[model samples]
Target: MLANPALQAFSMFLVGTALTLGDVHSHVWARACWCLTDVLFLMAFVQWLRWPGSYGRKLESIWYLRWGGRVSLRKAAEIVYSEARAQESVWAHAAERMSLDKSPDGILCYIAEVIKQDTTIYGKRPPSTHVEKLDPLQLKYGTVTNGAREVRMRDNAKTVFTDLQVDAKELRRALHEVRESLRTTMPI
Candidate 1:
């Protein structure tokens, strides 16, 4: 029960609801127990929701640093990958606790797939040495070409050209692909 928060919550909720709805209403002790159980279930649910073994937070942090000019895409990717690899055990434990259908190793392989996809996206930046240098003024204030916004050059002279809008459907498709791959790879 300690290992399975959802099950603990569900069992508590079931017993609490039964006590509240059934003939146990006349007993004050039963009502108090029910309230306690319900509160425990809520706490367990919140704890489960706040589980820190999430890749999304890591990705968001990388994106934030990149957008804020604190790190380049390549550097962000390296950090993200290193963090993901370091947290593999946490992720595996999370998978074991959260899922009964898929094995922990299967969840790890899913994480690997996401890491590969993200690496491809963030690793495609042009090498710093190959970046074409612009005028100092142009470097200070990047120009927009064909409506695409160009980000300022880093100290290493690498610039990022962004379209300012990402397709929501494409992002959803990538996430769905990761989930679908996990489902498909799991044993029946």
Candidate 2:
């Protein structure tokens, strides 16, 4: 972000020189200016770090990447498990044991849809329409971006996302167990 290395170096040099000069008039103003410069640099640095294109964005991407793979793994596991479960209850649907009431692929597809929606909302893909625009108010601000908002909204959003993550993992784990049990006859 700081493309002007010369300026940054000069400022650092000035600050250092000011620190060592130890003069009343010149040093005072120089140190004051240096302090001001440092504050400005710090703020800019903070902003850059928080920018959507910076490490902040990268971190978010990484999280989603990990979560996405986990979600996929969960989907894979679900497929395997569901097959095994289906085999056990081939005569009668095991709707009771698998009380989830939703197919693994169905949930994965739904989650995938949500991910697509999130990406579109967050501008991951090209915006399709104005109504599809993301509301900044929806972001999990405290964990990701610091914003002024009532506790309820943040808490609610965090809870929803957390639930989604947990459900995805649990479903995936079940599928993984199923896959492990029937490894030899795995469909795909």
Please tell me which predicted candidate would have the highest TM-score against the true structure.
1
Task: Give per-model TM-scores.
Answer: 0.29, 0.22
Candidate 2 ranges with C-alpha deviation above 4 Å: 1-13, 16-19, 22-25, 53-188
Task: Write candidate 1's Cα lDDT for 1-188 as tens digits.
Answer: 46565566566667667776786746675666667677777776676455344668655643654454333332332333334334443333443455433643334333333333332222112434333323434433442222122333354665664322222333334333433342322466
Q: What is the TM-score of candidate 2?
A: 0.22
Global CA lDDT computed for model 1: 0.42
Alpha-carbon deviation at 166 in model 2, angstroms: 36
Off by over 4 Å in 1: 45-50, 53-188
Residues 60-91, model 2: lDDT tens digits: 44454346533332232233333454444221
Best by lDDT: 1
- Candidate 1 backbone overlaps, count: 0
Weakest lDDT window of 10 consecutive positions for candidate 1: 116-125
